[model samples]
Target chain A: MTYLLKQLGREWRFMLRQRYVLILLLCSFLVSGFAVFTGLAEVAQQQQTIERLKLADAKDRLEAQAKYNDPGSLAYYSFHLTYSEPSNLAFAALGERDVYPWKHRVRMLALEGQIYESDSQNAELAQAGKIDFVFVISALAPLFIILLFHDLIASERSSGRHDLLVSTAKSKYALWGSRGIVRFVAVVLCLMVPFYLGAMISSTGFLTTLLVSIWCIAYLAFWTVLSLWLGKKLASAPRIASILIACWVLLAFVLPILSDLLINHSVHSAKGGDILLTQRETVNDAWDLPVSTTMDAFAATHPQYADYSYQGEGFDWGWYYAFQQVGDQASTDMSNDYRAAAAKKYTLAGYATLLSPPLLLQRKINRLANTDALAAFEYEQDIRDFHKALRMAYYPWLFGQKKFDKTQLTSLPQFEDSTHNYKKVQNEQ
Target chain B: MNNKKTQFAIEANSLHVDIKNAPILRNLSFQVAEGEIYALLGGNGAGKSTTLKTLLGFNQPSSGKVFIAGQEVYSALDFIRRKTAYLPESATLYPHLSAYENVQYFLSLADIKKSEDELNQAFQRVSLQESAWHRQLQTYSKGMRQKTAIALALLREAPIFLLDEPTSGLDPVAIDEFNQLVRELASSGASILMVTHDVYGACQVADRIGLLRNGELVGEYDAPENGRIDTEQVHAAFAQRKAL
Candidate 1:
């Protein structure tokens, strides 16, 4: 053990003297640090946005309750805030949150339109992606490793020191092995130290942090061993570097993009805009249709309300709400198809990750942080569940022809995000 | 061969080496006894460096055998490396390190600790200027770099030495000084096997000289008792062989 430490210590000091090596390590640290900083800032901004929206949503709902005594008017005017809060580890991954709506304010209206509203605005921005910790580790760390290790043996051979160093050293471990280990350890520390600091600051769980570290180390080991192997096989430093860089570009950028394109081409789905348009058109055209047409459509879904009749000639709350629900029912097939396609695309992307380790690591870390597409889908489902509860609570007062009381507003349902509930279950496990 | 293996510090018995299906050294053999300086003199394409590399265990012989200190080189590579010190043709030590640092780094690689004073003494012995001892080798001339590498080899204090074009960049005075050091090292029970194309340099210090031509030992010459080998005879033979 003493001898091993001595060998590693010698290499450590030797590596410290090279200016290019020092510069590369410093650049790695800076890049990793910047990524962690941006991720933390993004998560913080998201949490703050959720908090601000929650307060405003409460204030708006209170004003609506004071203005409307009828259940239908109160439900139409009040908007409930539902949000998927960032997990403690989300500051590192920040996965699908950038592409999906993490928070939404919805009234008792057609919900598919509200859920898909922001989807069109961020398609271009999502393609570019944020500089999060997962991105730094998966895509950029390999380049740093390739730069550090691609010349481990070739440089010695080029400089004419290979034979002399080989013959003089007591063991191979004392020379090449120790040097490679020192370099690998240096690059790993440069990349991971900032992540660990961010993890501590975010209060991430120990087991999650450990899993991330293990995965990162394993990923880096793949690149390190590859660089060293090619360095040994190849004779020129420039040639080895070129080959490694080409590999990085292929695995990190090309494969993921090609697979994404293939998956999109293979899977067909209804767009969010189409669903929004279809639902809105149905709701808008319902006013010109006969009263029997709207009431019969609503009664098919809600059989208990079949006996209830609207006595008022115009602006009856029950009739208005029935058509609103029928609009959602009209777009239900398209909405389901849209969700099914997204879920299928996500699963195929999981298979595609086998072709790109960077994508695989990103997926794993994002799943750990509960910032993946699955989590987003769950949040969407949560909004739907809450919207259903709201309809159940208000339909009785609306169709029963009973006198409305303002005090009964307390019985209205609140939105609870499934992401938070999932987190709670995970913590319990 | 068996008798020589027991008495010699370095031995090659009918060694053959092939690289990429092409023969480099064929049935080449030589031995360097303890406290003796043997030079393998050859020009370009004569397998001089290949022989040095084979002895250092950098290249494996396709057939025949190479032994260092009576043990097979391939089987006892670590032990052989520990017992040997090699100086490459150009002495290309780390350009980013000072002469002292380069020597210190190489020594530490061998896991042999040496004092600063001892390192300074090695540099002084090699006639490297004391002023340039602490400067990075990138700022040094070729001769200065060669001197630094030589100082490192001397500090190793190993039993066997393999020198490939050891004095390639040295001036007349430095060459003479290095030749004197070689003699001093050999006299102190170190075996030296050097490969070079310099006829005069080989004649000056080598106790015995082997003439290598196209990977084969073409001729052998020995110094008379207490005297140097004849330079003119070896040069004429080398020129005659080159013409053919």
Candidate 2:
């Protein structure tokens, strides 16, 4: 261990002497800091947007109360806002959150039309990908490994030091092993320091963040071992650099896109558009159908509402709500199938972790941050549950002929529980 | 204590090396005693450099075994390397570092920790100018770089030294100084193995000379004991042996 430490010191001193290494290291640190700051700004922007939407929704509700006190009008027109706050680790990965919606405005409509909504974002920036901790770990960390290990053997030979060093009694394995370990540890420290800082600022939990740090170190070790394995065979510094860079490009970029494309084509999403179309048709057709027919359809699935069944002459809240429930039931099968297909895609992507270390590591970081596609899927599902609660809360006032006053409005179902439930679901998983 | 341990500084018994499926050295065998200076003479592509590399454990022999300091080469590579220092034709020191820093870098790899003054002393022994010792090696000439390489070798304190064409690009004064340093190192009990194409230079400094042709040692001459060997006759013998 002492010998290994000495070797590590030599490696670091060598790096320090090189101007290019200092420049590159400085650039990497600045790049990481910029990425973190930008991500924080982005997260803050999202929170501000959510706040503004909440205020707008409140004002719209106040205006609706004065003009349309009817329970059916309030349920039809009022849209409550909800959002998922960024987890502490979000600055690390910033995964699918860039493309997915964290905040949405939902009313008491059939959820098929609202659940697939996305955030307002520039598509070009999303495609270019975020420069977060995930990018630093999976992409740039290997470049650092290549820079450290590519010349391990050839530089000694070129300087005429190779033979003299090898002529000692130390085994070939120890000579190479010590050199590999030194490079691996330096690269890990370079990545982990910034990552730890981000976690500290974000207030990430200790145990989970430590696991993230280990995952970062282990991923770097795998690359260092790989670089050494190639170094032994190549025998030339420049060739070793070329081969490892090629490996990095393959693992980090090509494999993920190819796997996602293949999986998406195989399963077929049956896009949420199919559900929206079906629900809209069922809801709009209610005006042409007799009131008793709509009530009968709603009563079929929700037998609890059968006691209040009534055929009112004109614009009764009972008739209005019966049609809404009828619309939701119409698209039930398509919605369930669409959700299953998305879940299957996520499962398939998870399988890719076994083959690609970079993807495995990226997934681990995002999972720790609670910003991945899995969390997105769960959050959307919770939104659906919140919509169901909204419908149930207004059913008695809308259908049972009870009047809703300002006090009653204050006591109505809110979206705070859905936000809390999203975090709890992530923790449990 | 001159231990009779049969301490061969380097031993290559019938070693062969092949590069790109073409044989460079075929069935070469040689040994240098613990404290003697041996010079290798050859034309271009005559396998002199390859012979040194094979002994150093850089090139694994296709067929035979190599032993340095009684330990099998390539088996205990770092062990063997730690006890030997090498100077190539053009040693590329880290250009960003001063001569002292370059020496210190190698010494650190050699596992020798020295204070700044001790490192400066190594440079002084190599006859590097005091001002140049603190300046970056990139500003130094070939002779200055070679001096720094020698300083690094001296700091390592290894038992064996392998030098490839060490006097190739040096001025006459630098060459004379390097030869004197070589004699001092040899007297200090470091075995020196050198490869050079300069026949006259080899005769001036080498205790023994070996001629290589087509990857084989064709002739051997003792400079101090069996002096004034015919170079033309030796070249003829090498050419005739090449036909076989």
Candidate 3:
């Protein structure tokens, strides 16, 4: 053990002397910090946009109330905003967040159309991927592993020290094992220290954050083992290096994209765009339908209002919104099937974790950050439920059966309580 | 003849080694007795280094076996290695550590823990300058690195020493010093097996010399009965063998 520690100390001193290690480590840190700054900026900008839209919503509702002042009109015109707050650890592995929308505004119209609206973003940046802890573990850690291991025995042999060292009483296992442990610790430290700092700043939960750190360390260990095994097998340095780098490219880059493409092709999701087009057609076509026909359809769905009289109305608020609710109810099953198909992609990706740890960690981070595909799907569910509540609140007043006073307007369901329970949802997933 | 056969300290009964399907050493046989300095003289590709590696158990013989001190070397690698010391033609120490640290590290690997003063004395015996002992090996010259490796081999105190062209790259003064060291070690009953191309140096220090050509030992010469052997005659014999 003492000999191993001494050798490890020597390796660390050697790494410190190599200018490239210092340069790469500092560059990685800077890149991580820059990525975090961009992530925080992106989240803050979305939050601000939501706030502006909410204010506009309040102003537009006030203007409409000055003229219509009907609860049914307010329900039809007013839009509700929903958003997911970024998790602290999201900065470390910014996976899939860029591709999925985080903030959404939805009306009491057909829920399917409002749910699939993607946020505005540059496609090139999302493709370039995030420069986060996932990048550190999956991309840069392999390079460091190669640096430490490519010449383990070949250098000694070329310089003619292999015979001398191998002739010693020390067993082969002890010699190679010590060398590998030193390199593994050094490379793992280079990844974990910056991650720990990011976790501390972001106040990530203690246990989950440690799991992330261990996952990275284990990944580096796997590479270290591979390097030593190959180094022992091959007689030349460059060949070993090339083989290890090839493995890195296959595991990190090629396999992941291949998995995604296969999953997407296998499970054909319904055209979310087609759902939006159909919902828009259905909602707008209600205007042309006879009022008696629309009311009968709405009354069948909401039968409590079958006895209510629309005595003598010129397009009464109650009768106007009855048809809107009926249009959303028309396509509920197809909307759900669309969401389930999209969510199956995540389930398929979960099976891929056993094949590649980078994918495992990628999904783990998205699951933790609550910015994954499933979260977006659940947010759609929330939109559907809230749209149902909006109709139930206004059916009586829309038929001219009751007066919607100022108190009734203030009692509308705002999106305050919907933002809670992220941590619990992550645990369940 | 003195009516005597040298008692073998190290012997290869019949050694063969194949690396990547190419025969490096083929059906070779040699021996070094206790207190005898044996020089293995060969051309660049004549399997001198390969023979040394086989004896040291770095390369497993394809057929036949090697014996060290009357014990077979096949499955007793740990036993054979513990009793042997080796110095390659060109050695590189850790570039980030001082010469003292390099010596200490090798000593520890050999399971020898010397005090600071004892270690310094070992370094001094090798004629390593005190001023450069503390400097990192990256700043060392070729001769300094060789001296450091020599210091390590001496400190290990193994009875059998295998050197592959040990004095290949040294200057005249360093080579002479190394030759003197080899003679002293042999006189103290340590068996020295050195593979070399410098026939004259081998003649100066080696008790017996053998010439290897085309993966076969072709000539063996003992020292002259008179004062000193004619190194030029031995060279002529080697050149004649190469021509054949």
Candidate 4:
């Protein structure tokens, strides 16, 4: 086709002349551009925050190194910070990142209370939740599809060209098909140009960018096909537009909210608040118990510390740490239950993603960005593992009653990103 | 008359058209022979459009058949469509497309791809004015749009032409140019079937005029070659039949 190209050229020229079409395309481009810009901005802010916190952590530990000579005093005062870094492609889609806490400061205490302490995220999101590229595709794109295609048949008929064009066209199917595809390509270009640019500038993986572009094409095709089918079926432009918009509001906005409410109402998830309250109660109650009561429980778990000699237990660092460990152990079942509920919610949401394409794409973008609920869960796991290392590092000195020199502060455990492990986890699923 | 219709370019044999169980055209029979320009004249709801649509194979006739260029229309609909150039009453053109673009696009869509020069020539023949040929059709008057349709038909070069109320909105000068163009196309051996309300214009250009009433042809007139058509008599006959 030379003929088809010529036809497409004609379509492009036509669109160029249409002020409204040009405006729609430009507006969409700008919105998506800003989404990319701010998404990157958001990720950059997180990175900077993490860097600032690490510096602060270094200073805080150095100060505590001088203040607390005993290993137990240092463990009590040290606040180890853990954070999740944004993926390279996260700028294209900041799904769930706006709502989730990516960084937290945990002390050597009962961890069930420390794990769920999210920074105030919702108020910030409410103030700054501009619909990102994710919103553009899932919510706004259908409107554009309707605008571009609703009048395909009705306008031709009303203008009195339908009979003429239909009667003389080589293949009427080709005519309609070309028209739809021309607009579809235009819509895709309008949305994806900024996305590709973001992906490029982010230095995202080449194959990933290609796969995402293809995915964008298939998703846009679904809307395009729907618009064409309804456009041809309805006899008037306004009617077609109204119906498609109604479908958009229902499918994109209302249905998702409804299903979310339903899922929340039905699913019984362990409450982080409940776990925190219980863990705090258990930890406080340990202060009244005999040293043997706390040590025996702690020793049951850490038998290596069972032989530690406790003398003058009125104010012992070893005895204090033993109780802290025992309090964490006391809430072990509740913490496990809390994690299981979160995992179940994620699973339920994964299944719910099937019914709404917008939800499906949001989850997909979240997965690519490593910014989903699962990613947060993995970060928490990293925190848990790092907390264990921190405890293990100190248990020997606290049990043997050895001097904890200030130089040992540098040897304290730091959190590592478990993205590879998470990948294995994702792949196995 | 029956013996003379063997080489007909369009043939509607005992056609009865119904839409949703309501009859639109009843036992309609007519033929436009090769190189003939036939005008089907009727008031509103007289089934003139129905007859044209049935011939186009858009509507399936309850009984009887339509044959275009010796092929039964429904069986080889696309084949028949390739042979015909249709201009509906409104002369609709894409508002965002320039006159040249509209014509060129339709030509290409009809699979009659032509050079830019040929497309320009078609536009020029319609006398669409060189200045406005590249201007978007939203800036066009009704007559300009009609002329562009004519250019499209010229490019199509189809053997059969269907013009539904082709002159409903044209000024006198544009109508004269249109009549001249239709005559040229017919003289070059294209069969023309025009459904028109302007009985006088039909009388001026059509070789034969048939009047339809209540979905049936009530009056038919044939013009002798080089003879003047009596417009007054044709109008009187149309008005008299509608009164009954």
Task: Looking at model 4 chain A, report the run of 10 residues with the lowest lDDT sum.
Answer: A420-429
lDDT tens readout by residue for model 4, A1-429? 877887777666656767887787887788778887887787788779977888887678768777878777888888877777788777877766666667778888878678754533355654565566677877777778778888888878776778887887777765787777777788789888998888878788887788667666777787778878998888788888888888888878787888788777877755676677677787788788777888888889988878887868478878877877776787778778767877887888888778877777777876877768888778778888988998888888889945666676666776776742222111100
Quote the lDDT for B52 in model 2.
Answer: 75
Model 3 lDDT per residue over A1-429, tens place: 776676566556555666665676666556555655665555556557756766776677677666666566666666666556566667676666677665666766666667654522345567766666676667777777776777788777776667777786466644556656665676566567767776777678898787776676777778877888898899799899999889888877788889988998898855766666666677788888777787888888878788766646476666656666666666666666776877787888889777876677667766666667776666556656666666566655666556768568665655532432442221100
**For candidate 3, lDDT tens digit of each residue in B1-244?**
1212235878876677898888887677888999888999877788888888888777888887788766677667777788888888886777777988887767666667778888788788778889999999989898888888888888888898988788866789888888889988988999999999888888888888888876678788887653445698789977786787
For candidate 2, write residues A1-429 as lDDT tens digits.
797677767666676666765665666666667776777667667667866777787888778776777788888878777677777678777888876778778888767667653422345557777788777878778887778777787776666556544543245544566666655565566667777777777677899788987898788888877888888777688888898988988898788888888898898755666777778889899979987788889888778777785645767767767787788888888788887998898889999777778999988888877788877777787787778878878886866746666568766766652332234321100
TM-score of each: 0.97, 0.89, 0.87, 0.92
Scored by TM against the true chain B, the candidates give 0.97, 0.89, 0.92, 0.95
Colliding pairs, model 1: none
Give the lDDT ranking, best first.
Answer: 1, 4, 2, 3
- Specify the poorest-scoring 10-residue window by lDDT in model 3 chain B: B1-10
Q: What's the true lDDT of residue A292 in model 1? A: 89
Return the top candidate by TM-score: 1
Query: Tens-digit lDDT track for model 4 on B1-244?
Result: 1222246899988889999999998888889998899999988899999888888888999998888988888887788899898888888788878887788777767767788898889888888899998898889898888888888888888999998988877899888988998999989999999998788999999999989988998888998769846788789988886678
lDDT, residue B25, model 3: 77
DockQ of 1: 0.89
CA lDDT scores, all candidates in order = 0.90, 0.75, 0.72, 0.80
Q: How close is candidate 1 to the true structure, as a TM-score?
A: 0.97
State how far residue A311 of model 1 sits from its true place (Å). Answer: 2.9
TM-score of chain B of 1: 0.97
